[model samples]
Target: MRLTIPLLAAALGLCAAPAFAADGKQLYLDNCAACHQPTGKGIDGAFPALAASKVVQGDPKEPIIRVLKGRGGMPAFSTELTDLEIAKVLTYARVTWGNKGKPVQPTQVTALRVGAKGPTVKPALAH
Candidate 1:
């Protein structure tokens, strides 16, 4: 009976997809879907479509850095999100929308953020 429970648990694990405390898909929905749209097609003339976008499909650093720094109309997430959260969302984007791209590791995000260009927070006003 000692081996039975262990074997049963091991077998159950195989049947399930790896779970995360916060799933990548859900993270994308919460953060990106509002602008990008659930379909990833995005709003025309407003938000750019992530679906099959060459940028998203290109280097992982490009998207990761864009998210961290914020380009043009996009707001920066450097302070709002963690490295792992950024990685998960970027990975979800790159892998989804039928775009062929490599997965972005959390370490890569950390590496790119070694010295952020600006202060992470705004200075409080002096009375």
Candidate 2:
């Protein structure tokens, strides 16, 4: 979810960047709500729930990289989503559904985007 500001802007097709996390709700509805659900509880085993997910909280970098690179059944959204949009979506997911990970910053996401090579598969649980 957490993409860099540059990536978010690219996703929105916007060049002008905004300060602070933008509308996370809007970002979710636009991209993830369909699969993740409005409540963040994903379908049974199809798209794992974000609520209290260790993957979501354990290492925010992984999810951000996933969104950027995609894996398995997930399509690569790196081209479609801008960095900022990714950041907002990750921030929203992290805070919602009892997830306690610190909000992902655009910069962190950007770092992952640059460093990550292939799909980032996490363990069943974040340790």
Candidate 3:
């Protein structure tokens, strides 16, 4: 039996597709790890610790925005990373390092990327 071109193309497409979360992890290691650290424990007072971070534990929006636009001390990843890439990194942080928060969806990140005027305010952590 001979493989058709269309069938071959479809198979290649599936094989070449990017795993978003896995890609995001790589991005985090390369771009975010220096400060956030591999274990997600950031340098003291320079970068906030990601483990059980209030920013990551609650709403995914604010953190997603930070990843895209960056914060006071953090560099903006908007020009550095694609929207999908930002979503993946944020999702990885949300779930890693003993943090039990939900994942940040790519669609949610994409929406925020589109509508953000500046950094969106997140709710304060409860005592």
How many clashing pairs in candidate 1? 0
TM-score for candidate 2, please give it: 0.71
Best by lDDT: 1
Q: Compose the digit string of candidate 3's lDDT tens values, residues 1-127.
A: 8889999977764443335446668888999999989889999978889988998888888897787777888987766766666767777787678777665656687788777665443322221
Regions of candidate 3 where Cα sits further than 4 Å from its true position: 1-20, 118-127
Q: CA lDDT of 113 in candidate 2?
A: 69
Off by over 4 Å in 1: 1-22, 121-127
lDDT of 1 by residue, 1-127 (tens): 3569879867664332123213568988988899999888999999999989999989877898888888878888887778877777787787687877666667788878765575482221221
Cα distance off (Å), candidate 2, residue 79: 0.9
lDDT, model 3, position 19: 51
Model 2 ranges off by over 4 Å: 1-22, 118-127
Instruction: Give each model a TM-score.
Output: 0.75, 0.71, 0.73
Model 1 alpha-carbon miss at residue 16, Å: 14
